[model samples]
Target: MEALGQAITSWVLEGHIVEVPGLGNIRAEVRAKAKSDASDVSADDIFRHHLLLTPTKEIKNALNSTPINITCFDKDGNEVNRD
Candidate 1:
């Protein structure tokens, strides 16, 4: 498990997308502010760097098919509503 995690991290850090079986493709992403002048742009313009995941169809389908149950309680711990 550790080795697999290391490999994923390494690939993403190297600007490559790593695909996980039955899950999705993960890649590194950055959000930067746009500058009118190309020369004005720099690494400082990048405010955030994160991972982006594009889930597979199978994973999306499984999530969509799953059911969610919600229950609400009153301040006194009495059941108010159930869904």
Candidate 2:
């Protein structure tokens, strides 16, 4: 899990597209904060970074049609499952 998380973070930060198996692509993008036509814009006035996730059609369909299960470890190191 740690390795996968690190890979996703590194790829996204480098503005590279990453395709996760059974999922879609993950990418980074930058956008202007303001939608004005004025030419008075500075670095601080822009939204520098954003992570975008485009999930695959199969994932989307499964998400809509099937029950999802989420498992996590509790503070006491006990496994918990959520639906």
Candidate 3:
């Protein structure tokens, strides 16, 4: 996750968003979408960027140790035989 954090920081500092290769989007925005015409804005008013990553089936299947087995149920609620 260090890489993700670093990428977000760099993007925010550079005043632009960065989409990591094979990863999620990271962008910065003002907190609560303050109005442009409003006054008394603080310098610390900045929204932190976030990073998201979608995992592949390899990771998901590995996490689920239990192998999947297809099954069917009959009208009486009994599991029908595959054969």
The lDDT leader among the candidates is: 1
Kindly report which residue stretches of model 1 are placed more than 4 angstroms away from their true locations once superposed: 74-78
Clashes of 3: 0
All models: lDDT?
Answer: 0.95, 0.85, 0.63
Q: What TM-score do all the candidates reach, one by one?
A: 0.82, 0.58, 0.33
The RMSD (Cα, Å) of candidate 1 is 1.8
lDDT of 1 by residue, 1-83 (tens): 99999999999999999999988999999999999999999999999999999999988999899998899999999999999
Candidate 2 lDDT over 1-83, as tens digits, reads 99999989988887789999888999987787774666777777776777788999998898899876788889998988654
Could you arrange the candidates by lDDT from highest to lowest?
A: 1, 2, 3
User: What tens-digit string does per-residue lDDT give for candidate 3 at 1-81?
Assistant: 998777678766777766656444555554544657668566566555444344555655676986767888899999986
Model 2 spans > 4 angstroms off = 35-39, 64-83
How high is the lDDT of residue 26 in model 1?
99
lDDT of 1 at 12: 93
Question: Candidate 2 local accuracy as lDDT?
Answer: 0.85
Q: Where does candidate 2 clash, by residue pair? A: none
Q: What C-alpha lDDT, on a 0 to 100 scale, does residue 28 get in candidate 2?
A: 85
